[model samples]
Target: MQPVINYLNTNSGEIINSLGQHLTISFIAAIIAILIAVPLAIILINHRKIGELVLQITSVIQTIPSLAILGLLIPLVGIGTIPAIIALVLYALMPVFANTYAGLTNIDPLLMEAADAFGVSWRFKLFKIQIPLALPMILTGIRQAVVMIIGTATLAALIGGGGLGTYILLGIQTNNNNALIVGAVLAAALALIASGLIRLLAKVPLKYLTFAIIGIFTLAGIGWGVKSLEFQQQETITIAGKMGGEPEILINMYKDIIENDQPQIKVKLKPNFGGTSFLFKGLQSQKIDVYPEFTGTVLQSLVKTDKAIPHRPRLAYQQAQKLLQSQYKMTYLAPMQYQNGYAVVVRRSTAAKYHLHTIADLTQFPALKAAFDPDFYQQSDGYPGLKKFYHLHFQNVKTMEPALRYEALAKGKVAVTDGYTTDPQIKKYKLVVLNDSRSFFPPYQGAPLVRTEFARSHPQIIKSLNKLQGQITTKQMQTMNYQVTVQHKKASQVAHQFLQQHGFLVQKSSKR
Candidate 1:
């Protein structure tokens, strides 16, 4: 409880910023949805035949996953707020459109006959009579749309659309329970608030309803126009990264470097964009200019070559780099000093008790129980390769979150766990990384991957980034991760401190 409170207190400003962003995106999406849906509903009410086909199409759009919609739009809209809002509008359409058509078409026939007898204009009847009676139903639809949009807006964060989802994704990556709960609670609160506000609006006199709706659109238009102008004026260089502490650090490092050295370029940090697949897609599609990636991830998981490569780091890196350059027109910068490869770790106490110092030594303890992350547990290059190479099999194996594996080991629930070589938990829990004497695991040296076209356009930026090569040691990365996960520092702050201590920022400042 105290942790939650402290986290909120410290991040209150960011929380407010995220809340504002969330509200803006939802409001814009809902307003746009209303504009399209209400008119379409009126058309459908008049022509029942075509309306059925239109509704079917909208229903199909609604069924598409929100995340998938964002992905499909990335090539067309190029990510960020535009694609996010477009996806939300599509999701918000079905409820409001259906309700509007139903409300207008289901009006009492006797009332329409009376209006017809009086020779009232159809337009006047729609504005004065039919719409007035259908206000509640339409408002109800609006309320539903607003609520759903607010909830769905969180997915916007996956595409670098800032909102509460930013905190939620960060929390998941860093294993911060407090941050995760805060984001979830705030998003729900926003949805409830939106629903409540729209319900209250339902009570407004029909005379002013049009005026109110018009005012809402007018204001949203002005805000969106201003935001669009801002986006257009800036030259943005988007830096994407996969989930986890290391990626966050590297992205922040790239962001800080570009922003500080070249103030003219807008550095957009798109954190928590899933794993290698998403990053690769972004690079290939020209949605992201740069991203931090691991060498082994490209070689084994992405490239999918079954032929055995040397267990050597340089050989593996060269092969992966060549493949990416040839196939995707992407370039890998010089590798960092650290290797963040998979390692089999055990508590120092257990290591001492069992005299386990290497992968071969583990074969003697066939009774040992182990835990692995789901991806590592199933990868052909993971347990299968390790087992075949080392001729060892654990008595029992469990799949669990990478963060929880340390706790499981601490509680003696598992004798061994799969861990990253540079994980901060390794140091915090006093875990011993067993040597892969037979070299079953491939090297995973850290590096930044950039699209060749982007690199060609920004030679200075590329040069500035190259200065980071071979700067961060494995211990240095572990300490930075510890600062973020254990001490709860922002990844950006840790990255800035690393840059300052290593004279990266100093060089930038000296130029000024």
Candidate 2:
């Protein structure tokens, strides 16, 4: 209770801003869905034949997983509000459109014919008769859409669409129950508010309800306009980040440096961009200029070779650098000193019980249950390779989101799980990381990856970025992650403080 209270107090401004974003996203998406779905429903009502197909198409879209839709949109729209809004609009369309189509098509033929016999305009007939009669059903559809959009809007954070989900994602990643609950509660509250407001319309006079709806939209528009002003710019340099605390911090650091040093470039950050493959496509399409990437990920996934590389960070970085340059016209910048490799971790109690100290110790526990993130589960350095190298097999190997794995281990749900060496949760949960004696997992030293052309064009920018080389250590990164995830600090604030403390960013004295 104290943690939750402290979280709310500390993050009040952020929560307010996130609430605005969440509402804005859901409202706009519902509006867009309404605009399209209602009009299409009207058109289709007259052409009953095509209405079935249109509703079915929208129904199919609703069936697609929200995360999958967001994933599919990232390569196409390159993350942020655009992709998030597009996906939400698609999700919102089904309920609103289906109800609208049903209401309009199910209208009495006698009334419509009377409206026709009155020599009224199709537009007039719709507004005067069809729309008024369909108002209840239409409003119900909108209410459903608004509520649905509120829920789906949380996923917006996965693709850099800032909302309450920011707190949720960070909380899960950092294992902060307070932040997660706060975010979840806020999102749910917003949904309830939207539903209650729409329900209010049912008890009001139709004319007043029309004005109330207009007023709601008008206020939403104003809120959106105000928020847009804060981020208004024709950004030239877009720094992207994959999902996770480390990448977000890196992108924030990059944004701070570039905007401070090269103001003319108009830097922007697209955080929570999809994983390696998605970001690779974004770079190829010029949707992103630069992003933080891991050396092992580049070598294993992007470069697409299973050939073993040198274990030393410098050697591995050089190998990845040469390969990326030759094959993809991409360049790797100076590596951050920290290595965020996969840690085969177990609860301290489990480690003590099994006398586990290294990967070889894991071989003794054939019945151990292992869990990992999807990417790790499929990667070369993941379960399969680890099993082959160490001649060990877990009784069960489960794949889940990286964030959930720590919680699972903490609850003793699994004996072992994959983890990043630099995750703060490792310290929080008092876990033991088995030493990779066999060197099964590759070293994943953090580094920035950029298009070769982009790097060449901005040599000075590259020079400033190189200042970060070998700056962040494993402990420093873990603490920073803890600060944001556990302490609820802003990523920009955390990054700025780190840079200033380390002499990378000099603080300007305030004028009296």
Top candidate (lDDT): 1
Alpha carbon lDDT of each predicted model: 0.84, 0.83
My TM-score estimates for the predictions, one after another, are: 0.91, 0.83
On the 0 to 100 scale, the lDDT of residue 474 in model 1 is: 87
**lDDT tens readout by residue for model 2, 109-207:** 999888889899988988888888888898899999999899988988776678888878767765678878999999999899889988887779778
lDDT of 1 by residue, 409-495 (tens): 978999998989889888888889999888888888888889888888889989889888877888899999888777777787799
Candidate 2 lands at a TM-score of: 0.83
Any runs in candidate 2 off by more than 4 Å, and if so which? 68-78, 106-123, 202-236, 259-271, 284-288, 346-358, 361-378, 391-417, 429-432, 486-490, 509-512
